[model samples]
Target: MTLHTLNLTPHGLGERVMPLAPTLTLRNGQRWVAQHYLRYQHTVESVSALLAQIDFDAHTPLFAGQDEQGVYVQVGLIGRENYDRSNTLRVHKLVYGRKWRIDADTPTSEIIQTAFLAIKKAREHEVRELLTVRSRDGKTSAAFSNHHDLPLLAQQRDQLQAGNHRVATLDVAAAVQHQLASLRFAQRAIELVQVLELSAGRVLIDVQLGAAPLARQLEGDFPEFEQLALCVLLPAARLHELPYALMDALIEHSDRHVDETFRFRGFARFSRSNQIQAIADLSLQTRPYAHDLADVQFEQIFRANNYEVDASRAPALGEGELGRKNRQLINQYENLLGHLPRGYEQTHETKMA
Candidate 1:
């Protein structure tokens, strides 16, 4: 059915949340899938079959949530289900539910207003999917990929049968936001970490120089950067600037290179391993929250953070005594430069007098 509007309710939330973080769980999940059983019958059958057959190895997780367009996918519910932050979305303040009570015939105006308000107040948002895949036996539902092409409910003819022949569905929540996802940028920074001398067998420079942004040095004109992990998290607005950063790096030294192992996708956690390299993991998280940060310094945290909260105080640059002093210094520097001889160079400080 075409969506006329959308609504959210917290009815029956308190009780259902105790056992697990409320999702389209195995319990009563069939009820929703039954609603669309006929149209997505084959798709349901396929998913159910896979869910039935997966061999849970020693390391395989008991649960999995994936994002698929047009499918009701679950956000990440990763790790030991304590539900503090490890399994939370990192972009928007996600509103969750024990059950998604779809309000049919909701006023278009209300839907529009909800969306409008989210858009007006939001700094950034994205569309994500949430589907449930449980590991229990004799169950049906296998839609686990971030990509799928299942039939919509309107196309089905058969009715949902709960037992024996069962199917589950994906939950498409609005990835809209009520606040902005903000990151604080450091000014006049230097790259603190580098492993070029130890890796790629490159010679180190004798004179110590400040660190560099490998992207800037390379100027984004390389063959292998398409797979570079940092680019995955690079903001879309700066995509054009990627090439320049890469170009700069490439021109400096052909042999000197970057460490490609650690790429930026989302929040990462590292623990000690017997091997030299620490084992790093990116947790499956959902629904980024903004409550952790001061409203002025930051807006929204876009990635699932396992890191501790520590906000650095940014120096106020204007409208204060310190600001006035800074401005006065800059003005003096400019005036001094203007009075000096043009194109004059003090090569080895030949003569100041």
Candidate 2:
């Protein structure tokens, strides 16, 4: 049976009807069916049954909500085996919902700069420790902070002198350390700045180092060492790669299974339809659905319409890195959808018409 004739409530299908007043007529004279946001409830068996009947295409927008037992019914867009109990399906679509304004007292840009400088200082301290050595007699000691200090320690055989094997070792080690520190600093700075922009500056680093020495310096309090280490070691690429891989998976899966009648085309196809709906929705309303629904309000709307929006899974803008990444991934996915072709026949027909 067609979707319109299906027993929506009995079969556990819930949908938000698009207002008829706002419809699009393409230049080809074909009326575009405004995309519908469907939320499906009930057990996996019933949902699977519903999936088997409907002929989903690149223009279909469907979302499966968590049931009363908190088990999410798998939407056939992704492989059934890959589907998890968690809400990974909706993450690439939902918005942050709240304003992420920057704080006037402590901007994230300044904090990141301070942390970067501290890491540099710590590296210098480590190099200094490595260069310092004591004589075998235990009567004298030589210390060198940089290459300029080499001359001062030249007379002492135990010290790192010009052309000394120890000096060469120190130079090589220092250069390698400097290069690594510089690369890490640049990567961390970019990722943190992106997070700030994505969150509208609402999220800030919890701790700031200012001019204080890092723990490795061993001179002053090291309260900021953890944050500094996190800045230096955290993998910025991981934050971006996860979502990129997910998008690639969706595309690859769609291309491989495009002709499979029993399986639903992957998220890339659903994304295309959702994007069209978003365009039409924006044309009719002042704000998009994300900004229109607050966290609690989103849950309420979902419940009122016979769907469930898991509060725990709903990402918050101010929650820091994960939240920022989620927003970024959503934008990237939507952009991908925009450039994608609808279908072979549909695209050709539109161009001919």
Candidate 3:
């Protein structure tokens, strides 16, 4: 007993059609045939019997006044899915349709909230996946009105921002957790280093308990305070070890230029050589001393070709005397800049030119 399968979409049962084939013509006056029906020897009588079994009348009209009996039936009625799977031999391929739209001036906060709400509603409706898309301008300088407009997603966000003064506000915990879950050991290690770097600035602050020591006093009164001490405060006590490490590194590389010094050089190089002269010009407004050499006043004197002595041959500073010595050097540098040589000014002008 061959059953009539009404295949609205190609549903194959072990390479055979299921729900049979709907031999009836569509309202658009199209006849669809099941994929399995074409694989075997088929006749009009057999097709008519299949149509009759599916309750599609052979004698009735279909669509705008087309006679159903004489209607053309394409061999692959199993619809798109089966046709796509079985018809690799065909020259022309199926062209999938996509919906495209343009939207303007949509607030990021609203978009995020709306997307969350829509996903929640779709879940409630038992739709496992409701394909949703939100689009916006991808301009690099789309001024972020609110910090919240910047997404903190682990992938989408970088670890830092700012032009001259850099800032790193990445969520370290989230990044580490994602790396751990994804089994990316190298990435996890990198994230751990980043976390350490992020927390490095606070490692030097001596967190001595105050004279009254309110934090210690509150530890007895509140359980929350004790928990905080155990979790947050106690763990940070280990940061005391970091200062020693920093001192050791400084000692080991006493003759070497430090990482921050190299960074400052890079910053200056970018300002001086690149199309970004504005950055250096702006820094001149804030911290002009940064453009000066380490000796400051001596650099000005050297540039002016005044005082033929070696500036580097200056007397070494005694212990705890660096502050006074640096101040004297800065004053000398300023005086030299004020009384610069005419030739030096000409050279400077030529460089600027």
Candidate 4:
């Protein structure tokens, strides 16, 4: 990445933010996703010092934002994760520093000057996001908000069907209400799941642990579609690895089994094509379905034995560092937002020039 000198002048072409080699720190309270992040600190005084070295008109708007509390400065970023490609501003690991909010009595000159300086400091710390400041009217001064393009999954239908695993759209709520008590603590080892997304035909979700989005999706789907189609993708190998007992239970649950268990009181609702609807009507009577399903995927991918999967027996065993990091993020999400996540903020595509 090319490191450009700051354009301190009142009017110069906007500079794009870039990345330097990222190194990880062992500090706690830091957020990690697929990898550890190198924390960069830019204190207020340090930013001011960097700005003092530059020359700019006090009234020249250096940063952008509609909120008077502070201007937004977006720096560039470099990383392998898909997240690294967008919204550098909202990401904590990419940009960390004291948020400079402008007070009502603050002078406009000071605001502009401070904003310019903040950008300089952010750049020095390897900020690579693009910032589009909007006013109370909810518009920005730029062309793009640096949002990632819509994933093909949103536009296409049934892309990842393998010859082995048949894809079925399992409603999100039905997937969530499963009594995967057997798999709860063991839930830490699997990859972080994107709710409702069909990767290889499965709508990824954490059935054992309660999902906030599940609640939100429930509110939306029931009122709207009554039966929203969500995918439960199972690879052919996972099916082959399933224990005979669990496999029999699934077949019975799906009504495909002709055994005596088919006479049980479970899934007595909804026609055969809508197992999720049947599960919903059963009030999650089919929760064991979650247990059996999660077990197969987690064990196959993480290679954890039943003992290792038990969080009580090995709290941190299956989770590994990545799980711990994600767990921290989950806690933060719960604290800041409600237990149910509204959803991720999509990048705004501006219509104005």
Candidate 5:
């Protein structure tokens, strides 16, 4: 039947929730089904068939409250005597004595709403199934070796069921690739830690020399990164304010200078590993600030942290004062260029002098 409006009782809510004229609708067979048991003539037969065939014994029943509209029938079951989250539509046989005050109307809004919701739920389940299959097939080619027959792999991946053999293999491969990539990136990050640990005298040279050579070795392309674990890989600068207190402490000292210099000292020494290798991760993370640092020096000690809860604005640093504060910064940077060992002194003098 077509919906007119809804007639909602506030159910103790204020004016916020009131019934409309036709809030619910019925399926085609619902009216016929309701008509068959208007007086519950077939109630006994329906109940007997439901109990004998379908499994309703798990549900509890409410014997007393039968509304006038006949929307819901509350019944008591053998196990549960109290009201619960059981769907009203799953009810098969509802036995009411002749003298019981059951609702008179066979087709109430409650019944209609339940039936409509069931149909909607069923449709959603089917849609999810189709989408899941499509997503699997689409993802298979990227995950499997290209040398394998594409069509065969696609067919096998698509045909995988909940407990099928190929399904386990696919799941395992996906999981392993994800984990291996994570380990690799993690190893790279550890090498970066080592880079950061290098003496300030060598840090800049190490980082600058490392970045280009590593890039060249990797063919100037970063590896594809995958998040196989709970935590994400972040640049040293980006580690600020991470949930882990250790990360916050490690990154807290990094500022506009740290961002620009870490690549020369910290990232240059970064070794590639199987644990962590996301190419774009660094792009998204906080990096060294872009400054005229082409002739910068690296600092020996990091600047003391600057944090204030009530400060109105950041304290400004003039160029010379900043240079004095982070002298090692330029050294590290120039040291990177000096790693070439040829004419290194000339470039270092020009940049740091």
Candidate 6:
């Protein structure tokens, strides 16, 4: 459906907007997918201007919203959920006629670095798979160790899958090697800037980064609240000092090296309350594997930060300032957990028992 033909309802303060579902095609024949739901606050005029700037043939408008500030329009690239920051800034500038900037900060840096690492690791894995192969005679030979053998072996594997094992191996190794070389060169030239720009844009949308108002607003509607367990809560002031690299490593390890032990989901920043805080959502499982992995990750974080890991180091009531803070955190955790759905309490109790 086209933006002009979209069924938009009057939102807050008489603004018109509507939510778009994933995989829905727009007038220009592009599908939309959102990594997470987002709301944008914009005005009617601004929305119209933004629509005019959009090349429907190239971009996809995911959804729209309105608020006290203005009308917010969520837009994405043709086939990606997460797009480059330049695209978002272009939309903002088109609507408001001013440049929008995202400050380079630690959180932004970490997010970009994490994304780059994930992409590089994936590519290296593909290369490894291509390197590990056997010949048609089911034997390893130095003759098959040439660069051409990689794609030839890959094609042979495809032929085997198609039940055509008798197909003769052709001398197309040089072409495949050339293609691989070109791909490698292009990846080296563009992947850095591309990943950084894409991840920088993501910072404005990521709920964990606490940069997007719409993302924060939608946090209240997160469906996994019942399944989430608060693993750690640190003062907002300590955000810069926290072991983010360790956290990223643990997440990568869980995702790549191990099975589904546990996932370090993301962070939730609470700044509206009396005391600003950052909560790490390490929704741990009851399984032994989960416990072991959690223990190791936490221990590394604590040690790297020079925090005590022993139970005895935990402050006693009225003994030390650290004790007071620890008690307050325990109370906060309990309060949050208690307010969850009824079944959650039972499951948590059973797990503890």
For every candidate in turn, the CA RMSD to the true structure comes to 31.2, 24.8, 35.2, 29.1, 33.0, 25.8
What are the models' TM-scores? Answer: 0.15, 0.20, 0.12, 0.14, 0.14, 0.16
Residue 40 local lDDT, model 5: 20
Model 5: per-residue Cα lDDT over 1-353, one tens digit each: 34212122222211111111112123332211112111222132232222232211132222323245432323332321112212222223333222122222222322323322332232222212211111323331112112347687678995743332222322432432332222212112211111221232211101101122332233311111111112223233322211232222222222212222212112411223312445344322323223212223311111111111112122333245553444435446633531233222343335536
- Candidate No. with top TM-score: 2
If ranked by lDDT, best first, what sequence of candidates would result? 4, 2, 6, 3, 5, 1
lDDT of each: 0.23, 0.30, 0.27, 0.30, 0.26, 0.28
Cα-lDDT of candidate 3: 0.27
Residue 269 of model 3, lDDT score = 27
Which stretches in model 3 have alpha-carbon errors above 4 Å? 1-279, 282-304, 307-353
How far off is residue 3 in model 4, in Å? 32
Tell me which of candidates 1 and 6 scores higher on TM-score: 6
- Per-residue alpha-carbon lDDT of candidate 3 for residues 1-353, written as tens digits (9 for 90 to 100): 23334333232211222222224333345554423222222233333323232211121111111133332222111111211212133233222111111011122222222322322222222111111111244212111111234456445556543233222334333433342232211011111222333254331221111121343232221111121110111123233233233223222232122111212112422122445566555433433233333455535543443232223224343334664454444444433533332233322322121
Which scores higher on TM-score, 3 or 6? 6
lDDT of 2 at 171: 41
Candidate 4 structure quality by residue, lDDT tens digits, 102-170:
432233234444544454443322211221223346443221223334475456546734345332344
Q: Mark the 10 consecutive residues where model 2 has the least summed lDDT.
A: 185-194
**Model 6, residue 103: C-alpha shift (Å):** 28
Relative to the unseen true structure, what is the Cα RMSD of model 4? 29.1
Between the candidate structures 4 and 6, which one is better when assessed by TM-score?
Answer: 6
**Alpha carbon lDDT of residue 68, candidate 4?**
47
Model 5 residue 337 distance off true place after TM-score fit, in angstroms: 92
